[model samples]
Target: MTPTAAPVLIVEDDRNVLDITSFVLESAGYPVLTAMNAEEALLVLAGHPEVGLILTDVNMPGQMDGIDLVRRLRESGNPVRCVVVSGDALHAADRLGDLAPFLAKPYDRRSLLGAVQAALVA
Candidate 1:
């Protein structure tokens, strides 16, 4: 049998947030991979070429933050779209500038899903 494709990868250090995001995406019928940090996220990305979208938290435990991770990927010619979720709404756009869209923390289900949909279709 052919393996299922994973279209989205969620990188968040917070366990609860990760679980909730994964559940939400799964409920929407999108296959997802979860990673606690950028390092692990790279591994998941390497393993899942089908992943076309990345939902990540700006503040993470790894040396490379979410923005940096996305920057690296873009620099390396990886076309996977990224959406950054963070509590720091005031400057997330400035910090993440041109890398991807920024969704402030405490986002509602509609906002979250909407951002994902927009990024995917962008």
Candidate 2:
């Protein structure tokens, strides 16, 4: 697949949130992959080089949260783009800096699609 058409890897512990996000992205014609936490996300990324973007929740039940996951990816020199989503937007944004775009939780379809599209092009 082309870079823009590459799959989006979503890391979310909440099954409902994961399902909704996947549905929205897939309905918009983007390929989707999912992991429940950062560890699973890392494994998925290692196995799927075609995953161009990561849309991850900030909080999860794992050794590494979403921010840590992005930091790990960056520290390891992975160039895949990322978008961080959280209900606690302020805290996440403060820590995230320019690492990735922040999309607040309870995001509507339009906002979610907009963030994903922007990150894909970025």
Candidate 3:
């Protein structure tokens, strides 16, 4: 039998967004891990190094914002792909350049899934 695919981590402060993201990705055949903040996300990542992708919202409440998380993870040379989602379009877009791919809030489900696929490839 084939092993299951790696889980996709969804880190968004909004419960609804998290739920919907998890639902969408899981429905598309990927397992899901959900966290509300960057710190919790880091904890999840520490335990699940096999996670294939991280979908995070930039304006999370706490010390480590999404951009910081992306930078840190990339610096550590982890293979986990990242996609930063935020309402601060320009600001977040600027920060994602070297860190990872990104998607804006209110994005279409197709776009979200597309980003997930691409980030996983990154």
Candidate 4:
């Protein structure tokens, strides 16, 4: 499927953040799916092959955080694009390198949507 037409999976541990992000994307007319952690995100991806983008938080309560999740997907040859969000931008950028785009925590709706759109097209 074309990335623009596919769903965006948001993986975040915070309920408030997840809900708000989902709401923002959905309100803007993008299809969205959500998971609270990397494991759940993996499961959701397995079931939803149409998910073209993943917007995941770097820190989460699970065996694997967003970085590991992205790494695993890469190792397995999953081509789904990713946009990672974290409060610690420098640390996350150092760890992520060119793996995915990074968005800082407490982002405004426009920034969040812009990052997602950029990733989708990338």
TM-score of 2: 0.96
Best by TM-score: 2
* Candidate 3 off by > 4 Å: 1-4
**TM-score of every candidate relative to the true structure:** 0.92, 0.96, 0.92, 0.96
lDDT of 3 at 22: 87
Candidate with better lDDT, 1 vs 2: 2
Give Cα-based local distance difference scores for all models: 0.87, 0.94, 0.86, 0.92
For candidate 3, what's the RMSD? 2.4
lDDT minimum window of 10 residues, candidate 4: 1-10
**Of models 1 and 3, which has the larger lDDT?**
1
lDDT of 1 by residue, 1-122 (tens): 11224578999999999999988888877888899999999999999888978999988996999998999999999988899999988777788887789999988878988898888777
| lDDT of each residue in 37-116, candidate 2, tens digit only | 99999999999999989999999998999999999999999999999999999999999999889999999999999899
Q: Of models 1 and 4, which has the larger TM-score? A: 4
Pairs with steric clashes in candidate 4: none
Clashing pairs in 3: none
Please give the ranking of all candidate structures by TM-score, highest first, separated by commas: 2, 4, 1, 3
RMSD over all Cα atoms, model 2: 1.7
Backbone clashes counted, model 2: 0
- Which pairs of residues have clashing backbones in candidate 1? none
Predicted structure with the largest lDDT when compared to the true one: 2
Error of 1 at 33 (Å): 0.5
